[model samples]
Target: MNDVYRIIVNHSQLISFWDFAEQPGQEAVAKGPFPYRLTEMAGPIERVEDGPFGAAAQVKLGQWWNLPRHACPELNFHGKDAKLTVLAWLKRENIPNRGCEAIAGIWNETEKKRQYCMFVNLNIWDSADQVCGHVSAVGGPTPGYKYCMTSAIGSTPIVKEEWHCVAFTYDGQYAKVYLDGVLDEREDFNPYLYDSGLFDGGDDGANFTVAAVHRSNEMGNFYTGAIGGLAVFKEALGEDELAELCKITV
Candidate 1:
């Protein structure tokens, strides 16, 4: 596994939105004309269109929507000893309840049956001030493996409507969570818990996804808010690499 981590997308990667925009005679009527100004960011994200309110849709905290899982596609990182890092800028809405909800994570889907391989859920148990990070192994009739870690940040909470940087890094042996460039929590799991070819192996057809799950109900307790700057790294980033990522003002 390489120690160097790199940013895959930063708004500068978006290309043309014409391909994703509704055409003259398409199966579905256009929701609204494509907002050319929005695509000016980086690479075009499919299924996303300019909303009446603005560019990407803004979701309130604790409010969950299934919508089109494809809107935010999966990001794939390949390597056995790989360290995966997911970072995003977000603003939490001050909802009456802070129920547990997944901020974002990777998942697997086949038809209607959806399985969450890993995710973050907040305000579990309706506490309105608690959060938990969970990672699962396998899915099916057999009991799928699940491990969880909790933190107290949910209480004081970062300001409700400010840009907050949240990041999670998982090496083969441990998973670390960071808040605004600061180490917050860590969980060590049995590396053997994963079966051969589970993550990047060709058999499982593994892929990375962003922002929410394909099935709305799956996000049950957690999932509400606006998210941006979603970036994935193939390798575990060192302290310096993480600092650089946080320093990016754009």
Candidate 2:
């Protein structure tokens, strides 16, 4: 592991990572003192050249992957009083079909439920030209569930076909989103803890899929575009550090 990762993991909670640099025919590879490997599941999700971090993964035509949740509970942030940060490079090929489209998420294993999610909210009808999204979570008890809290970005039209760095962070109170290395949006949510419960997933966290959420696993809601790279930090990165990361290019 590098000195930077050691420092980041020191204070953060759950950090899922994928660089899409797996060697040909290899069983997926992840970074860290505790390595977590992922398996490519559905089709059309291929490896390609050029990415912010390195080799990139192409997600289009309903393709995605199943990631094994990283080992060590400290690396899992789907629970309460969590400090979560997700950073990734996105290149949208076109406006995905109307309605909510998920970028990635872990929902209740039983189905039709959610724990935490990061996604772009599109219109239901194909005519609306607005662009927006949210980073949401289902906190507290189940029946008495806190109804899902969200942090959204407004009128940003993030569906364009160009590489853009996106980052989302939730530190137990407010949800902040950064786009292209700049703070794009920020929303304050009712403070509470996230409960992973049955949806905490299993073994390397392979039970969950990427480019889409466990809830909308089936259908055309999966993201249709390219993911240059992805990383999760247990703790929200300092603005200066995050800005430095955004300076990296393909």
Candidate 3:
């Protein structure tokens, strides 16, 4: 295993980690205590030999991975004290639509079941092409806005065709976004505070989705690029821990 995989697996709070080494048309197996597998959905994604890790999933707009909510109980993080961390190693690429990109989460905007999702270029608060940590404590938009406005938006733009480590975490107080293992600080933005905690999306809530989300009555916000690795934790990781995880080399 690579250093990144080893570090994540050793963490006590780790929920799941996907290395994206599986072949095309095969299920992406997650390694951890839960080991919940993600099924390829919508369309086929290529498995390329080149990546930050050994292999990667090269995806397009229509491709994604799905894990039914009920089937993966460990990923259903909620409640007043709920904490979470999601990290991904991705080679970003520009899409034709140029809309926000969803990396992973249980966010389902159509059903108002939004919880939390790691995103890029959310195009909100005068922000674009930056790492975003979208969180919803009410499963709907913030009181005065049409869209969910609670998020920690990073300052750095995600450059295309380059591998970068992007991540976000919630510590029951603030939602923080990180780029390349460091907090890409933006005042009142990178450490967006919301103490209400995560929303419990119940039994009929959203499914865990990767590279896309169900929004506006259809699947959209597709992340087009190569995803080399992904990991989820039940607790927010510290800055040093994230820095170490980003040190992995192919």
What TM-score, over all chains together, does every model reach? Answer: 0.52, 0.71, 0.97
Q: Clashing residue pairs in candidate 3, if any? A: none
Per-model root-mean-square deviation over C-alphas: 9.5, 5.5, 1.3
lDDT value, candidate 1, whole model: 0.38
* Best-to-worst ranking by TM-score: 3, 2, 1
* Model 1: lDDT of residue 198: 21
Residue runs of model 1 more than 4 Å from their true location after superposition: 1-57, 60-74, 77-80, 108-133, 140-156, 186-209, 214-222, 248-250
Taking the tens digit of each residue's C-alpha lDDT, what string does model 3 give over 1-250?
A: 6666777877899999998888888899898887898999976679887787689999977799999999898888888888999999999775554788999999999999999999998999999899999989899888898989999999888888888999899999999998888999998998888898899999999999999999999999989999999999999988888888887631
lDDT scores of the candidates, listed in order: 0.38, 0.53, 0.89
Q: Top model by lDDT, which number?
A: 3
Q: How well is each residue in 25-75 modelled by candidate 1, as lDDT tens digits?
A: 221211212212211111223233332112333454323322133332323
Give Cα distance to truth, residue 33, candidate 2, Å.
2.7
Ranking by lDDT: 3, 2, 1
- List model 2 lDDT by residue over 26-60, tens digit each: 54565654456656666435767766656777776
